[model samples]
Target: MEKTYTVSVFTENSIGMMNRVTIVFTRRHLNIDSITASESEVPGVFRYTIVLRTTRQQVDKVVGQLEKVIDVIKAFVHEENDIVHQEVALYKIRTETLTNGDVEKVIREHHARVLTVDPQFMVIEKTGHVEETQLLFEKLRPYGVLEFARSGRVAVTKPMKELSTYLEEI
Candidate 1:
């Protein structure tokens, strides 16, 4: 069965590494649902959180192939229950539509923050699971949303051991 899987890839900083890693999945005809890359806890290492909907066997194959890429230090596959994940979404709404107190109520109900306010528009930010962000977008659509963007999934495993800990052991 196909389900969401998070691939945690660790690598040394190097040019073209992302492309190489991504190509592994592409060659297998897999679609990446979302991906976020950032510096890892260790100063020189980087981590990529890649989400995809695939069977366990395919994800395992992808991770194995990712590990073969140059500069790739390690690759891990995690089920949703194994990790804590979040995505950030930003919404721009026209100011005229947010003139009433109801706007504040809506924001409060959604646990979103107004990042900036101008005479013409307001920017609202929300960080949570993807589903929450999508729901907020649906709710705001009726209120004249001018723009919207959601970042890819960013996640860490729930295990007490940190990535840095493993890096240290090496």
Candidate 2:
């Protein structure tokens, strides 16, 4: 059965490493739902969080392949329950609509906050799961959403041990 998987890849900073890491998925004809890369807790080491929907066997194979990449120090595949994750979404809506409707109530109900309010438009920020962000988008659409953007998933494993510990063991 197909299920969502988050692949956490730890690597050294290197040029073209991202392209090399992504090519493994491309060759397997797999589509990445979301990908985010940033520096890890350890200085100079980077982490790539990639989300994809595929079979467990396929994901395992991908992780094995990712580990073989030149710059990859370690690669791990995690089920949704194994990690805690969140995505941030930003919505830009017309300011005029706020005065005409109960958009404030809707925003409050969704637990989203206005980051900026200008004469023309207001930017609302929501941080949560993809579904939660999309829900907020839907609720604000009727009010006039000028723009919307959601970041890729950022996650950390549930285990008490940190990535540095794992790196040291290796």
Candidate 3:
């Protein structure tokens, strides 16, 4: 069965490491749904949060391969329930929509915030699970969304232990 799995890869920041990590998926004929990379809690270490829809066996193999990468300090595969995750989505709605009270109502209902209000467009930002963002997008579509972008999943295990602890242990 195909189910979403979040792969959290911790590594030292280096050039061409992403290419190598992504290539492993390509070689295995897997599709990467989303990928987000940013500095982690530990200084100098970076985290790559990659989302993929595949079976447990495949995800296990992929994580194993990722851990073998020279720069990869650790790699973990987590099911949706195992981690606390969120994605940020930004919607650029037509400024004219702001004239009517409907847009504001929708934003309040969804708990979304207006990041910027420009004459040409008003940017609304929502940070939540995938479904939450999709629901907001659906509601805002009628108002005219000039642009919509959602970032890849960023996740951390639910356990209280920080990744830095694991890094120190190893």
Among the numbered candidates, top TM-score falls to 2
Candidate 2 weakest lDDT stretch, 10 residues: 98-107
lDDT of 2 by residue, 59-159 (tens): 99999999998989999999999999999999999999977559999999999999999999999999999999999999999999999999999999998
Q: lDDT scores for all predictions?
A: 0.93, 0.96, 0.94
- lDDT string, candidate 3, 34-108, tens digits: 999999999999999999999999999999998898999999899989999999999999999888799999999
Those runs of model 3 whose alpha carbons end farther than 4 Å from true positions after fitting are none
Q: For model 3, what is the C-alpha lDDT against the true structure?
A: 0.94
The most accurate candidate by lDDT is 2
Over 4 Å off, model 2: none
Per-residue error at 65 for model 3, in Å?
0.8
Estimate TM-scores for all models. 0.96, 0.98, 0.95
Query: How close to the true structure is residue 106 of candidate 1, measured as C-alpha lDDT?
Result: 83
Clashes of 2: 0
What CA RMSD would candidate 1 show? 1.1
- Clashing residue pairs in all predictions, respectively, total 0, 0, 0
Clashing pairs in 1: none
Superior candidate under TM-score, 1 versus 3:
1
